[model samples]
Target: MLSIAMSTLRERWVAFVVSLVALALGVGIIATIALVMNSALTGFPGQRAALTGTVVLLSVSAGVTGFATVFIVASTFALTVIQRTRELALFRLIGATPQQVRRMIVIEALLLAAIGCVAGVVISLVGAPVLASVLASSGLAPSWFEVSISPVPLVLVCLGGMGLTALSVSVASRRAATIRPTQSLRESAGDPPGARPGRSARTGWGVALLLISLMGMGVVAAVLPELATVPVVYLWVLLTLVAAVALLAPALVLPVLRLLTLPWARGGSAIGTLVRENTLTMARRTAATTLPILITAGMSISLLGALETIGHAQSVEAGERLRADYVLVPEGGPAISAEALDRARKIPGVRIAPLAPTTVQVTGEAGLADGFWGYATDAQRFAAMTSLPLIDGTLEDFGPGGIVVSDIWELGAGQRVTVTPDGGKPVQLTVAAVVGDSAGGGDFYLDVSDTGPRPAEAAYVQAGGEAAAALRERSGELGASLLTKAEWAATVGNSDQGTGVIGMLVTLGIAIVYSCIAIVNTMVMAATARRRDLTLLRLLGATSRQAVAALLAESVVIAAAAMVLATAASAINFAGLLAALTQVVPGATLAVPWAPVLAFAATSALLAILATTLTATAAVRTPAPLSE
Candidate 1:
């Protein structure tokens, strides 16, 4: 079996090369993520500091990459098997058992996986520093971070890659086993197996899986609301929907193509009609081409939409939470001093609200939580300059020795809590006010005087008519930059924007790369496979230009079908994400980044055109026809 598999791979190395490269790259990405996670765990202390949201992001990305790798590897290998239909049929005629044939294919996959996994590990070794640098630059990792190389993650990833590759070949192996002994005498290869047993089974599975996932989510929302905060929920739902579409893709392609080709069939040029018919006849080819597109576009749009929506929500909340006309703060410098606060307040008709910011370790009824962003401010002045939407108690009680908590806290006003400021003695304080979660900052607020002589990190000033202009001029003299409410909101938005963009790029970048490789390989092979037909068309009076145009049109039609299907799958993914976010983090609105989505679609189309056109043009440049 090993010898036979090696011989077969030697014979078909051209077709196997792309599958090998793609699998290696995909596996490399997954291994890199694992290494990064391991490094963070060993280097960073505490669960929150090490990985929380970042872990979720990396896991989702790895899941998408793994899914795509399976799809592309399986499709490419299946295509290779189809090309050897007659050869396999001859082996069957020679009395090779179906089991032997299946073993042969599986062995081939294992061997390929071994090679790919080794290559992937080597690539990951080179890529680790680059990955760490990127994470550091994006503020996702600390400056002291360095990649930790360990054999554990590499071995695990290698085994995982091998397992995925073997599983992916099941469909291809089954197809090979089912080849009849008589097929060796046929002129061309028969159709590869359908995506599933039948249309009804495929449709049934798609609906059943979708419903089951939705039901599971509904249960999570109702019974365990906190579980909705887990990113796995989003990843599972997205991959489940993607799998259903993959099952249904082959069955649905022809009908969709027919429906879309009606206008072209009626009045378009002969080349257009020919292109449409050619794509329709090749269902497996079309499915292989479209699957990667669906995954790439679906993942890209869904993730970008989710991140942008969350960022927009945060920005909006920040803007609405501010009540002061202008906020003054040093730009990454030392805190503002009492002299600066005095100078600002000396301006005519101005009332200054000073806030000393510090993080504290809280020991309360809910247990110990550290690094809570707490600010100390004068209650009366704070109340005069800003509004706190209270869930309980009033700002009038927010004086010396008093504290305010956000709605997320279990402790309310009148509860005794121990707050330990960094380098300070733990003090017992009474919570005077419990504000709504949208209060937009640290949960704990203490009296300014009790927070000691720590300089003020921020201050909000309310100025009347003439005092507003006077305040703006003396802002620099007070050693702080003055920003209007809108400007302050913009500053906050910019910070979130950096994080969001980084996340978006890392998640979507892998998918797009896979999509490009799949498109180019499928288009080149498709064109090459139909070379005889193209030559015959030219012999029958069709011009080379027309032939190329037909191929171009065919590429467009396949890309269009892929985009439509991908959009549908993405809608499902986005809906699932929105549902989870609503339960976990309330008040987040759905924000679709139309520009990025459109750009992704346009790039897919352009790649398809360029790939198909170049391949078709080269294939049709033959000097003369040869007898098959």
Candidate 2:
């Protein structure tokens, strides 16, 4: 069986090569992510909170990429087995038992996986350092962070890759093993059957996955609404939906292709007819090719779109929360000088609220021991300058002896919590109010007297009409940069957001690269496997140019279907995310990064076109064989 598997692999190297490459890329990405994450986890001690976001990002990336890898590998193996239907039938005719056939297929998969995993590990050796640098430069990790080389992770990844391949092949092999030799031989002479035995089962699984995804979204929206903005939650939901779409892809391919190719199909051109018929006749192959593009386009749009939506929501929320007419920020220092605040307050009709940002250590609660960020300000003036969402008590209750804590702390009104201010002694203060979590806002608020003599980080001024202009001029004279409420909100919204987005993009880059490789590999494999069909077209009086054109048109149809399905997936993901966000951040709108999405779609289409046309052209140029 091993020798037979080796011989069969050599004979069909072109098809197996695609599977090998896909598996290799998958393993490489997983390995690299593992090494980097291991380093991040071990390198940061006592600063885990600071590295929490980065680690989460890495974990999500690994999970998504791993899912995609398994999916692509399974699809590749299924297609490869299906394409070898005739060969497998011949083996059965020669007295090979079903068990033997299955064993041979498994052996072939293990062989391919073994080689692929080794190559993948090599790829990771070079990729880890580069990825580490990206994380450090993006500020997601410390500059001193480095990938720690460990044989344990590498060995485990290799073994895991092999195991995954074997498992995927086992499932795919069942069909090949069960098919009657005569039926397979007959089917191989023409287009493979469109409907398979387990199609209903596949549909059931797909529907079940989709239902699970929706249920998850509903649960998040109704319960943990704050998690809507968390990338891992939405990303997992998106990938689940993508998997459902993938499972249902064969059923989706024909209908979508027909609609997408309507103009070309209705043109009464022979090439168009051939293209439509070819893709529809081999819907499984078309679906397989479409999966990569679907993943690429869907993921790119969902990740980028979600980031934009969340960022925009935060920005809008910030602007809406402030009732101030102008904001004054110090130009050259961390804190605004008392002289600047004095001058700003002297302006007539202007009420100023100076916010002194500081950190405080809490020794009472178990989790609160890491210290909390808060602001010291004149409670009365602060209440007048902003409309904070308060869950308990009122802004008026916030005074010299009282503190306002975020609801996240679970501190209720009138509860006493001991907090030590930076450079100050521990003091117990009463929680006068509990405010909802607001982005870019402190976790707690304290009166200036309780927080020592800290200077204001920024001042909020409630001034309108001529008072606003006068305050702005006065701010200039004091060498402080003055911005209107809208301008300041925009600045706050944009701050510290890019680091996260960049980190996510860096992680997503791995998946995108793998998807691109899969796209090319699948297209080339699909095209090359159709040498017989191309030869038939040539024998039926079609020119090489016509054959290639038809193939290219079919590739376009598949790419179009992929893009359409990807758009739907992304829209579904965005809708679910927005539903959750609306529960947390009211009036959250969808933010689609159309330019990047379109660019990625175009690139996917172009790769599909080139791979199909180039491979089809070569296949058609070969003379038809006189016998099988």
Report, for every candidate in turn, its global Cα lDDT versus the true structure: 0.72, 0.80
The digit string of per-residue lDDT tens for model 2 on 273-294 reads: 8777777776766776788888
Q: Give the clashing pairs for model 1.
A: none
The total number of steric clashes, by the backbone 3 Å criterion, in model 1 comes to 0
Residue 483 miss distance in model 1 (angstroms): 3.0
For each candidate, give its TM-score against the true structure.
0.80, 0.85
Task: Give residue 142's error in model 1 in angstroms.
Answer: 3.7
Error of 1 at 77 (Å): 3.3
How far in Å is the alpha carbon of 354 misplaced in model 1?
8.0
Instruction: Let me know the TM-score candidate 2 reaches against the reference structure.
Output: 0.85
Worst 10 residues of 2 by lDDT: 492-501
| lDDT of model 1, residue 242 | 68
Q: Model 1 — TM-score against the truth?
A: 0.80
